[model samples]
Target: MNTEKFLELLVEELELENPLTLASNLKELEEWDSMTAMLLIGVVSNEFGKTLSAEDIKELTTVQSLVDKIGAQQFS
Candidate 1:
């Protein structure tokens, strides 16, 4: 998927009022939590065919970090 579609899906899945950008801080998001992290892990696995450990999730400080984990090449 492209970055735009990824961000759009993330906004919907995370149930955020505000749209997410690559620069969006994960810590600053009110919807971000353990459940959210788990959700993200699942999304990456299912959508991008990648696995993210809890440690990896903890290190994700921004949307771009997660995107990087999923792989920059995974996006258009």
Candidate 2:
């Protein structure tokens, strides 16, 4: 996916007031709760056709990490 679309989806999923910029930390968001975590996992899986567990989602602390994971899957 393109970076703009990714950021837009991230912003929508996390319910961020500000537009998501590059290298934004997911943990920094006050709305980053368990429900949001689950939503992110679902979004990534659905968008990329990759399965991710809750533990895997928990491991991704930053937006960069999440983008890396998606890119890695794209190449794999």
Instruction: Give the clash count for each candidate.
Output: 0, 0
Candidate 2: residue pairs that collide:
none
Model 1 alpha-carbon drift over 4 Å, by segment: none
lDDT of 2: 0.78
List where candidate 2 sits over 4 angstroms from the true fold: 72-76
Candidate 2 structure quality by residue, lDDT tens digits, 1-76: 6777788987887687877766777878877788888888888888888778877787887777887877854532
RMSD of candidates 1 onward, in order = 0.9, 2.5
Per-residue lDDT of model 1, residues 9-65, tens digit only = 988887889999999998889888889888888888889789999899888888898
lDDT of 1 at 3: 95
Candidate 1 accuracy as lDDT: 0.88
